[model samples]
Target: MTSRSRHTAAALALLTLAVACSTGDGAPAAAPSGPPASGRAAKDVHVAFVGAAANLNFSQEMMEGAKYAGQELGADVQVVAPPGPDGQAEVGLFQQVVATAKDGVSVMTLNPELFTRPAADAIAKGVPVVAADVPLAKDSGVTTLVSNDNPAAGAMLADAVLTRLPAGKKGTIVLGVPTPGLPVLEARLKGMKERLLAKNPGLEVLGPFDSKQAPDDNYKAWSGLVRAHSGALAFLDAGDPAAFNLPKIKQETSASWLCAAFDLNDAGLAAIKSGQSVGVADPQHWLKGYVATRLLIERALGKREIPKGFWDSGAAMVTEDNVDEVIARQKGPEARAAWYKKLIDEQFADVQGRMKPLS
Candidate 1:
């Protein structure tokens, strides 16, 4: 099969998986805007996945999802990212990509405010833009947003920590992220802080420290935070797996700090298994990329109507109690293959059945 044919085939497979895993009682999955067709769009639609280079795993999964969509739609998909930690470099890269006037572009929107003008210019040039993992309403040029239900996910994180904390009273919990001013990180912190405040009246959110999304930096930042806030009862890692691997710091600290992190990868899974972290809030990131590309493909191909608003692919809660079952539920590409499989097996079975005719 050609790349386009492969992606179309994968899209059929993915819809099957999404429907199967989403519903509890094996209900049929809902239909998406796009349907498989005989001919690809005349114009080759180009899709781009933009984000941080340092965090390769997440972006790579997002790219894979986009590529899957691109292959199905006969799109030319490109994954572009900033070379380093500098947000300014990312801004420049966005300008360069937007300047090209690609057919469709999906960005992570790490800092929406900075990219708003350039994003608007891209839209003016006829590039339909979608922001992922972060909302960009401030950028009127952005057509849609693909994200998780972050605050609810944040609340889920808080609940995990609260469940482990001392009974009947809230204690101080530190929130860790990659940075302070970045839009996505800020939203996550806002959601987490709100959830922590609402659930445990006695619970106080202490730090939104910059973990830098690096393992060593996670170790260092966490070490200092734990030392300064020795009374802290819990730690909420709002971003990556590195935050969960703080056992060394936890061991040295006088206070017993319970941990809760977002998402699960090998490291985060290991941390949960070791009993170091209590639970995780997974945003079903693969779905975010998969659906975003699906919507764009449908639009570019004139196959269906494109919605004006955004889509929240939603998040799934995984705790130490359920980690084994969750891990058992996956098959395929290690990056997103398992989630895609679970989707097919669970939520989208009805949609899966419908797709058979197209295949």
Candidate 2:
């Protein structure tokens, strides 16, 4: 549809949706309509991601992107997260803001399924929602998902390990997994497992050994698995204890064992460069945040537009060969985001081509 048509549809939806004002009744209440009272992103314009406001998940980078966009747009953007990583909490926080928050929203998925209903609810309440990281249901009214093809990412991360394996050689590979039941991680593991086994029939994939979402628990889980699964050729992980914390734990236990995970932290990158671990998959965290804010702001103000499908944020693998290049890009927050944008334009040509320049 044309921009004018889309905007008209959005405006009608906004004014017509049931607005639960102070009375909590499903009636149109005196909610703030259209844009900030004064600027692009005034205090009234709140945007939230998945993790808590304080936790050091990828949301930190996302928040940074929000801040960057807010500053550029001359708006005061409020960044918040659910109290925990749980989807219910995320939806709860979303509902809380639905009544009070004006302007746009972006939510990274902990559980995309649960998000569909709440996302529809938010849309009904006239808030344009952007699904970042994990995608909402295909039918959900919310369009513009700024995320990766997670299972594809998993298969990609798996290739990092698969290539290094001696030709025609296959053995047991251990998986250090983050907490259970997250859709994104599950897809990652699925991709990793399918590819790893497909390449070498003799290869055995074992234990998405729970990382438990804590440094200590993750270390314990991985270490215990390693000790039990001796002769394991390589250890692989999409993230969590597998990504950020496993480096130190692996060093302490079995430095020679090949390991891989997705995403990165300072220590994880160092491990990759030093060759303690195989590699870390780059999820393009900065881009997810940047694109999310860009989408939310545009849709809120009736400017930018995207098709029904997800804007795959794309992924990359940082191995020993490219470790230095990745390190330079990650020197600081700005550097990290800048590097990703460069790659996004180069690698995700379709997204870049379609993304309307938010002037």
Candidate 3:
């Protein structure tokens, strides 16, 4: 099915589930008068999950987490995204959700500034908003931010690259950014360059060249860069498309440059297993989605006060040593949710304690 059709089907299914779990008056079914009830107080709550692009693997992984959270919490989670990274289109969707969402909305965007006003308005209208993946500004009026520490993840990627290079190696490394000027990507690139230079001043870091958001265009951009910089020591990317495409390019061209990027798309995993790329810096997208939705549900149910700051969703590095384990954990939505159950319980148990000021 087409991407739009898939999104429609998923939303409809979640809505149907929500209705089935509600009472005739459209209120959540009352908990049984016995021992403490399981955590399904959000039976009729409707939460919206908005993403920057529907076609990207990172976004799909996040949607999976959102859907799984709905299943676990008995909430209705509707997912939507633009076909590509169109910030304007994403802002429009966020505005619409803010006006209509019954419970709350969680949005992941490349352009957080575009969302500031709409998010503030949503908060004023009693609709909570959580910034997922890319964080909004400190005063964006979002209930909380669930995302990886992008700069730290970037430095981690640089450290991974450093392992592949010899000490005092004097060579070039190219950085590809699927969306230039994106706060998260720029922060990651900044951290990476700084780390790389600090560790190996002899290394020459090249452009965070614009690797377009569309898959086809992104591949083309990486392919052109590889061809133009045949002698570069390594290629690192701050986006998902490159994680999948760079390995393909490396294999097809029989290039010797080390390749690494962010995200754990299937192709990228395969590349790691086959030793085509060094590793991927995982932003834990699924966890971010689940945390955002769960927080919104808790707020709607009056179970908890959603924190108003940055909640570090965490990050990881997927390499040959742990690729199989990561693959097993990601076998399906249920498996992914189960794997994160402990972490979720801990974080939700002390939401405020886990949050740090949004910097």
Candidate 4:
């Protein structure tokens, strides 16, 4: 059918369905009107997503993609998020979600050691589990981790920073990371630092900043480093959100410096577009969320054992040249709808008929 015809049919069908439904008191109830209801109740698979609240946009994108997959598989995807960026609250939220004994769980391991035993216990009790953003180590109980190649991601950032510097200019470069021991962020930081230092012998590496990847804190730490070392040439921010605020630092400081950043959010995208930020790296989170959900639903449907391994979802760098394309692709509601469609097509290819979304 033509697009217009299809839309009209959908509208009429929704109107008819609305009239057929009754209220709790036997009066006509206001029916939800839009696309058809997602067949979430049909499939018994239950998936849980646990993530930090401060990274709402990032977490929401992953959940949105997963929910897209769940709709395609007619599975129910339950997302239990912590209150905010507080690590303690995140731990508490995980405990609550695991206690519910959902069929499947996909958690972002901000603190793997803290959650490993608890996650393992949930797995031991027969709940299939996976990790996202940060992966579980060999001893961790998660069945799989959907993440990017951190070292490679770091290398990309370093490459961008080095490319902009004068061929022979030598100065200290400060690398900012979320935490000292966070394997993922550290891997990237190490890769960037080592690669840059290897090529430039005269460069002095100031440090791996201990800032918790919070914007305000990062600004203070980064600004202090820049001020202390008037000779510093570049700044490496491991995440994009922090990278987005580099303009303020540049405006306030009288020194000229280069910056390499990662991830894409509204602020980060705008920063790149306006040339305030040098680069933002993406791990193709849209694909990660889509694939992770598919793996979970596959196990639930076929009684297959959950797959456990590290999958590098992949990464891409956005600079001044392609910032517009990146930002344009993520413009609004259509962007999400397109991502959901892609997830459904790529992950649920085998179960085309069963694939659907929950409203």
Worst 10 residues of 2 by lDDT: 19-28
- The lDDT per prediction is 0.61, 0.65, 0.81, 0.63
Candidate 2 per-residue C-alpha lDDT over 1-359 given as tens digits, one digit per residue, 9 for 90 to 100 = 77644543343233221211121221111113333323332333454443322354565666666555554443445556643354555555556555544566777755677777877877887777777776677566776777777788888888888788886686788886675767778888999999888878788889787766655667777777778886888888766446656677677765566788877677788888777888988887777876777555444444434335567667888898998998897788667656666654453344435543211
Please list all clashing residue pairs in model 2, or write none if there are none: 41-75, 41-76
RMSD of each: 9.3, 11.1, 5.4, 12.3
Candidate 3 or 2, higher TM-score: 3
- Residue 287 shift from truth in candidate 2, angstroms: 0.5
Q: Tell me how many residue pairs clash in candidate 1.
A: 21
In candidate 3, position 341 carries an lDDT of: 77
- Give residue 119's error in model 4 in angstroms: 0.4
| Clashing residue pairs found in predicted model 3 | none
- Across 1-359, the per-residue lDDT of candidate 3 in tens digits comes to 77755554454343322211332332223222323433455666788888877778888777777776777766777777776677776776676566557689999988888888888888788888888888787677775789878989999999998998899999999999988998889989998999999999999999999988788999999999998999999999999999889999999998888999999888899999999989999998999888888777766766666778889988989989999999898788767877887787676656677888877
Q: Rank candidates, TM-score, best first.
A: 3, 4, 2, 1
Candidate numbers sorted by lDDT from highest down:
3, 2, 4, 1
Q: Once superposed on the true structure, which residue ranges of model 1 sit more than 4 Å away at CA? A: 1-43, 54-57, 72-74, 96-101, 137-140, 251-255, 325-338, 341-359
lDDT of 4 by residue, 11-44 (tens): 3233211001111231111122323433333255
Candidate 4, residue 300: lDDT: 55
